[model samples]
Target: MTNGSPSESAISPGKPGQSTAVHVRDVTMDFGNGALAVSNASFELETGKFLTILGPSGSGKTTLLRMIAGFETPTSGEITVNGKPVDSAPPHRRSIGMVFQKLALFPHMTAAENIAFPLKMRRFNPKTIPGRVDEFLDLVKLGGYGNRRINELSGGQQQRVAIARALVFKPELLLLDEPLAALDVKLREEMQLEFRRIQHELGVTTINVTHDQREALVVSDDIIVMDGGRIQQHAKPVDLYRAPDNAFVAGFLGVASFINGHAVPGGLASGENFLSGTHAGDFADGTAVRGAVRAEQIRIAAEGGQLTACDTRLTGTVRDTIFEGERQLYVVATEEIPGITFRIYHHDPESFGLFEIGTRVMIGWNARDMKIFESRAS
Candidate 1:
């Protein structure tokens, strides 16, 4: 139903059920005969869910989004929307809405006029345009500001207006390509929450492309982490963060330390030190493997423990220390492992605050906390 203003009812359509909204099957995109921009990428988008393509620069996220938007066609494979083949369909006919990095609002138009532009193109009744505009403005929380000029509104307000305008057409899918990237840090964060709220309220299927991991984790129901044009992992935010599939995935998500060790009778052996834990992958006895541990997982203890039965412990010297407001970070150089450095995160006084640079210390962690990956040969 239309609200007091045409913009008031400009809610994103509710999400559909388990039925797929967009499907990319074995899609690949290449420029001329050169390198591939998207290499055999494939994924399914559920109706009403938010899926984010996350990666570093040149990872082909934008190109993949463009393909979904009908701005660029895949070199091979098929794309379907709502069970219908859309590979040959033109953008306007595909029933989709897009918001770019730049808001792309008309400078000369009032907020109401800008929101009404899409409806006008659809040949909507002129008499009904005002009501629709008012409905959408209210929905975007800009109900009374319809008459304000584009330049008159703040950056955030302009963003809401752009969103309202795109939704005015009521497309089946929405594609946002880092729409908040241009805003200031605070504004970007605020907009991220606002967009998520709006998306959930409307339940429309969405595909967002961003290089910011935090942004992706905060806004997405499922995240696709990409590297070198290939998807490294697709999982819920918590799973990807806690249990990364590989060394690259582990390091990319946050700070980590890699330690090399050889498999022994009881556990893994590194020089004179042995760490006990269940092995993760297939590795024969005496085979060398690399173990990774997050900074927060490494525990620091005062020297001279009775070598009690613990997971793993190594004696080391505090090479450097840095105080980070709430947490203390220490770079320790160990005698059992030379040239190998360990980072420890200390937040409590009894745990981390007592350590100082040049102090002798012992670092240890539970075997379960350490992730062992198959070592690659040089």
Candidate 2:
């Protein structure tokens, strides 16, 4: 599949009596020398759902996706497709369609030819192939552009062709391998919408792998966050964003600031001040824990002006500010928190530098906004 040709599958209708599209149980992959690429991972995907495996580079997200795609066999556990074990099934025999990062369409072939390749390879009726190709070209909003060659088409158009080629055979499941990673920010975001639109329109069970957190949140019905070859958390996008299971997830999902302290009666105590927060892990009196608060959750104002609604308040000097076009990110340093800094996002892009570096400001957040997690060392 990485060699510019997909490991193709023939057309397969959904197996009756199975609502689950893919099931992975206790899957592990060892690459010798005590290297575990995937560690005891397990999950279930319902039919007609979009699941994204998201993580940073070398987090084994790609490896896990590959295992499910049948490119790499798991060292332990089983993967079932449509209620049947496919441990011995090769890539092309698993009723799965794959679109790779490279787009993998033939440069010499026209867009229509690229889309029609899978149908032809799978031995679909030659007469039906043309219509099927046209239907998908229209589905991807590239109807009349199919006559153009791969190089002649834009990057987004080529991606559409790859998606069309992969799905033209109507495989039971679709696998996306970071198909939008190479596009520029604007184009990548645009393709994310296109991907979601296509997935919803087709209602095909799909699994995608990517390191983009925004992409995961935008396109996935459910997401699996992986790190160090381990599955950290899996949940719907909203649930995962609002209720992270641990410190890593809380910090990973959003631009968050962390302050270390000992757990007090209701929240965390640093120095003589106590900051109220919601606790996610077991906390005893004086237990060391770190509290995480998203940047956007903290309200910032000129000292003591409009922060009466906040449960916790602090005065900090602006150490740095970044222009993010749509929002301004401020890094504030406060001495009251005992060697802690805070990041606050002001969405008013019109006021680019609300407070220049070294300006004093008051920052506050409600108790429910901060999440406290037990420190690993504790």
The candidate that wins on lDDT is 2
Off by over 4 Å in 2: 1-18, 349-353
> Candidate 1 at 339: error in angstroms?
3.3
lDDT of 2 by residue, 1-378 (tens): 111111222233453224788899999999885779999999999887899999989889999988888888899989987877765665666578899989788999999999998878878888877787888888888989989989999998888899988887778889999999999999999999998998877778899999999999999999999988999999999999999998888888989999898898778998888898998867688888889999999988876567989999898888898988888999998768857789999998695438889888999999889999888762
Candidate 2's displacement at residue 276, Å, is 1.1
lDDT of 1 by residue, 1-378 (tens): 434432244333433666788899998989775778888989998888899998888888898898888788889977887777775676666678888889899999999999999889888888888887887788789989999999999999999998888777777788899888889889889888887987877777889999888898899998888877778788888898888776666777767888888876556778877776556666788887777788898888779854354578889999898888678888999888787898878776545346778999888888777777667674
TM-score of 1: 0.86
What's the true lDDT of residue 366 in model 1? 80
Clash pairs detected, candidate 2: none
Residue-level error in angstroms, candidate 1, position 68:
1.1
Candidate 1: lDDT of 297? Answer: 82
List candidate 1 stretches off by more than 4 Å.
1-15, 32-34, 260-272, 276-289, 305-310, 348-354, 375-378
Q: Each candidate's lDDT (Cα)?
A: 0.81, 0.86
